[model samples]
Target: MENSRRSSLKLFFFVIIFILLAPQALSESDECAAEANNSCNNKARALKLKIIAIVSILMTSMIGVCLPLVTQSVPALSPERSLFVIVKAFASGIILATGFMHVLPDSFDMLSSACLKDNPWHKFPFTGFVAMLSAIVTLAIDSMATSLYAKKQSPGTSGHVVPEGDREMGVEVVSGGENNNFQFHGHHHGSVAVGKDDGSKLLRKRVIAMVLELGIIVHSVVIGLGLGASNNTCTIKGLVAALCFHQMFEGMGLGGCILQAEYKLVKKVVMAFFFSVTTPFGIALGIALSTTYRENSPRALITVGLLNASSAGLLIYMALVDLLAADFMGSKMQGSIKLQIKSLAAVLLGAGGMSLMAKWA
Candidate 1:
């Protein structure tokens, strides 16, 4: 009877403790639920705005990028025309601005966000470093691909020897045996033909277009993801207009590259499709992942910030070195000071516009 009474007493005490803690646990759970509901509401609002922005951006991008390609039919806009050169210069300038003003800055902001740890992030300029590395990688890819193509097309050791009949085209030997001279001329013509077969400027342009598209796509998707994940109405409103203009200008830059490539209709369409849809696709993905994703969360911030930095580096490098420097230094721009100044002004205008958009976007 004594042991049974002690056991009951212990059980009674345990029950009292559980009862005392139950309200606190319930209160915490309720608070968590409220927080989650608020988050969901915010996400829902952002998702709706993102849908509209995606559609608008897609249309703007398609129109902008397709303009130059479609303009090929106009005689004045033909690749060899002066007007075309000027237009291309303007487009290159825009791309240069985008790389420097827009993408790079965004990357810096993301990587340095307070959500991330201070030890490595604040200690080192990871954004700049990543960007620098990306640029170097891009250069490596560009140079190596060009060199490989050159080697593949070279006729060294693989050139075919001409047959006697093909080599001898009826050159009668005159006073000092002009036949030998004729034979030497034939050898020179053969070498010229081989060289023509080996190298092509068209091929180089195509490679450039493909690589540029890849770089552009990286940032496009990231921007779209950001827009999609955001639930702030104030942000979305401003972003809609800024993003529309952003896509349009970027499309123009890409369009200029596509035009230079001289790709077939199918290839042109493919390139255009990629640029147009990347952002929208990113938005869609963000919508799908919104439930689990927290923009300011440590993991999310680090991943996104690093990605932006790397992409920014690539854009900056390509814009300044590959596109601007190459064209401005080329014979076309060098021959005309007026055109150079116009292009410089255009670049500044583009950079300014994009920089302003950064305030909201």
Candidate 2:
């Protein structure tokens, strides 16, 4: 456990050092000179567009994240419903596509940019290497955090977390001691067997959720940096629209994860707020440093590329192993062929929609 903590700390420390190592310069590149001129001519217009992008994207992000959370108030959208299962599967698929179709390719492009060195850069696959290390680090953190949180929980204490939808029914969460069953006591007595996991599974679910948020935050900052640093009004027009949809879809994915994580109101609010503001914060920073920061610069490319690669790995792993497999391989999903079929279709739809968006981005 101590080793795991050290690994997590080291990973973060390394990322900070890597970012600090970036070469800072304000000189514009020759290739970008023409775009820069065009942007200068339409400077006021481009600023207006960027401001619009920030405000609209922020609202869309908030709406997207809050959508699933609001479901806690709707009886029809209860977590136990097949619809919830399908939507979660769809959300997982969206995350999967984000890693595979979006982040991974972007990393490849940036690392392979002509601006980078020919010797070491071309000779090595830094993107894949960094991604692999990041996935391993994420796994370590996930395992360590879950185990620690589970240990901290009092085994003898009984806790009640009444979901909003079940409040009208006076529902109380009942942990099945040393068993895999989760009892929700309402007007009627019944057991919903949560299958093949001890009560610690709930703790694990909560702990693992923060990792998903971490990855999403990293991806958001990268996306925002690109849009913020670019002066090309033509690209910004299309990118702003694409990014709004991007945040909306990704927000749905994160929202679904948060919904299942069983966080308290305060924690949920904090997570959602951080997610809602990350991209905008990144965009603001980019705009402030637009004169000095070049997206295509060797240092900038390396930093963003590595960050994207790491995020891609974390998202891909969580979506596949933690989110999808954990849900699908459970007794309930495996036992129901109809549910499986429905979930697969939902996954396809979500993945296809996100993949299609990649074309414009």
Best by lDDT: 2
TM-score of each: 0.75, 0.82
lDDT of 1: 0.67
lDDT of 2 by residue, 143-258 (tens): 98776655544344443222223334444344567542344455656644333244466656666667888888888877887777777788788888888987887888788778
Write the residue-wise lDDT of candidate 1 on 90-116 in tens digits: 666666666677777876876777756
Error of 2 at 191 (Å): 12
> Model 2, which residues run further than 4 Å from truth?
1-41, 155-198
Give me the candidate number with maximum TM-score: 2
Question: Any idea how many clashes model 1 has?
Answer: 0
RMSD of each: 18.3, 5.8
Superposed model 1: Cα runs more than 4 Å off? 1-44, 152-200
